[model samples]
Target: MFLDILLYIFIGIIVLQFIYYIGIFSVFSFKKAEKKNPNHVPVSVIVCAKNEAENVTRLIPELLNQNYPDFEIILIDDASSDETLEIFEEFEKQHSKIRLVKVENNEAFWGNKKYALTLGIKTAKKPYLLFTDADCFIPSNQWIAEMTAHFTEKKTIVLGYGKYKKIKGSLLNKLIRYETLLTAIQYFSWAKKGKPYMGVGRNLAYNQSEFYKVNGFIDHMSIRSGDDDLFINQAATKNNTEICYSLESFTISEPKTTFNSWYRQKRRHVSTASHYKFFDKAQLALFYACNISFFILAIVLLVTQHQWILVTALIAFRYLFTWISVGCGAGKLHEKDVVYWYPFLEVTLIFTQFSVFIHNKFSKPVHWK
Candidate 1:
């Protein structure tokens, strides 16, 4: 009787978890950008580069050609040994809107990228600040307009999606893209519900004043990373944050080519999880616990007793519902192809991410870009 009761309890938890994934996560379906004047606000787009001459030559021009008026592009050269400085200087000569801040890396400097970003933000000329990476490609010229359109008087922080470019015929590529989509659904859904916890630096914006008000990474100076999400985690509130889901607002960047490279990248990202607020950490923990438990419970029940039919039915219901919800989200994010890999990748990520989380705690600390 005790075993039977335990099985039912586990089954009940699984059902609730499935409901949350579908019912709560499906909030993305209703996500729409609130109408506002895209051109009204003057934005300073900041890109901090170390040694990305090739990418700068190819992608920076595209950013300069953006359709928005009354905006400046602040490119920070963080002591590059390559041709990055030359490229920035050339662009500066060609366009007056482009401002280059050259930094010579010194051993005496206190922080890493956070220090560099602080310098960039300090030099920004506009009230509103937008940030992206050197490798990021803006899909449309209206990227600024779409991202800024969501900003209002109360909404100081604007969160936008940054996706990895699709690589053909690669399983790793598919999993990477699906993993990004899954992470997006969680962050985006929470933001829509007014519990904005984080934002990606690759495509994010906020008011320059608010950043200084929070002291701008002063709290996390000793720790590396968090230049993006950690700052957002600290500054964002229910009333002060908004999200942008329009395809026009999206930014795409190159994905790491090897498994080791990708793993290190994800490790660096997960390292910031330890510094998140207690509530945010708890929220993420519950989701991961339920995900891991679902699989473990299913296997134990199958082994202890022969309830194959019932177990199969339960699994089928959970899987089908989750697929529908994820499929809708994928379509909304312009990641329609990710839905096909959802079933396999979802289960794989449950284990893979657990391993990464554990390894991150004990492994050598990851540094800033």
Candidate 2:
């Protein structure tokens, strides 16, 4: 009887996993992208930098030459000890629309990018604010126009896609790209279903009025990270938030080549998860737990009862179904290469994410830019 009970428990977990996959299918299957009209609302593009002189040297020109009309680039110099300030000064001279907001490194104000970004928003003359990082590059000049086009009536928030550049073949590079796509799948799918929880800071947009209405991240100011997600978590609504998936709207950033750098980057991002609203937190936790639990139980069922037929069928069904649904999502997101690695990446991603989630509990908060 004890052996039979153990078998039933494992079977139940696999059933739960199947149900979760079905939920993903339902969300993706019924959703269709909406048409957007071209909108030329005056926008302020904000870039906060600590010491990104090299990157901005190549990045600022792209901002100035965008295909949109009436947009200004707000480059905030957050106490850079490098050539960042000098470079921006030169750009400001050449381009009349470029505005510079400098944050002095004082004992009172140091290391917080959120504070610097808030200053940028305050200095912006435009009604709309579109944010990206210094290390990121626009795919095309149409980036601004495409993102702003989604700001229809009542749509106050726009979430845009940001991708990492593909590097020389390595396990870490592939994993990093796959992880980014996986994150995109979750947030985008949820947003499509009218339950947006967060967005990437690298490419996101919102109205200037909404910033002051929420008091501008005052609650989470102490947090060094989450200038993007935490703000949106508080500000986004079913009727107010919309996502822009146009190919030209995306931004690409250089990926961390070393494992240590990537690990630290992910830790800072995961640290913000604790601050998410309860419902959103529980939903994300459930997805991770179910995914890991499903595979663990399948292994036990195979080992203990030699239930080869049952175990094989369930695992096969999961792998095949997930490949199909996530493959479709990958295609839509321009992450087609990740589809080939989904099965192998499943085990790798779950274990790494579980480790990071546990580590985040004891980790000291790190500075973000």
Candidate 3:
């Protein structure tokens, strides 16, 4: 009877998560009607480069060529040990609006990226700021214009989608794509509902004043990451946060080739998850717990041969829920191909995330590129 009660409770939690996913899908579908303006607020595009000489040389040009009326590109060379600064200097010599800043020394208690961004933000001439990594390529010339359109609606922070460029004949490529799609769905859904908890730094924008208002990375200076999501979480109010899903505003980055590299990157990201607010933490914990619970329930049912009907029903409902929710999100992000890999992705995600949770709890600090 106790096991039955626990099973029912787990089933109920899964059902609730399923309902939450469906509700998000409905909201996203309804939000599809909102159109963006071509002429919007001016923006300052910020890129932080660390040992990315090749990326700075190749991708920085595309950012400078964005079809926006008024904008500046500020590149912060975060003590890079490569030709990253040299590349930026070459670009600066050619482009008038492109400025370069170098952080040679660690100032007391600031993380590398956050310190660089703080310098960039202070140097920015515009009120609006759009941030993307040096390794990412803007998909369209109108990227800045499309992204800035959201600010006209009084939004202080706008989170845009960052996807991986498609690479064939690689499992790591598919896994990275799947991870990107999954994150886009959750973050975009939450943003659309005016309940955003985090934003990816790779392609995100916010007001210059808002960053200062929240004291800007002062809270998480010791932690390596959170330059993007944590800042957004602190500054994002219901009236001031918006999400952009337009293809013109999208940015693409290269994927990690090896499993070890990917795992380390994800672990670094997950390390910051604990620093979020109570409600945000609860929501994420609940989501992960549901996934873990469903997996365990499946195993228990197979072993005990008990509550078979309830287990089957819950499993069916869970799959259907994930399909629609993740599918709708993928559709909005222009990643419909991810739907085909959802089943495999789901299983891997549950296992990997659990491992990440355990590893993060016990592992020492590790750096990544």
List candidate 3 stretches off by more than 4 Å.
29-33, 107-111
How far in Å is the alpha carbon of 288 misplaced in model 3?
A: 0.4
Off by over 4 Å in 2: 1-20, 25-30
Clashing pairs in 1: none
Writing each residue's lDDT as its tens digit, candidate 1 over 288-369 gives 8888888888788788774767877887888888888788888888888978878788888888899898897788656754
lDDT of 2 at 148: 96
**For every candidate, C-alpha RMSD to the true structure in Å:** 1.7, 1.8, 1.8
Which prediction has more favorable lDDT, 1 or 3? 1
Candidate 1 C-alpha error for residue 361, in Å: 2.2
Ranked by TM-score, top first: 1, 2, 3
- Per-residue error (Å), model 2, residue 1: 4.2
- Candidate 2, backbone clash total: 0
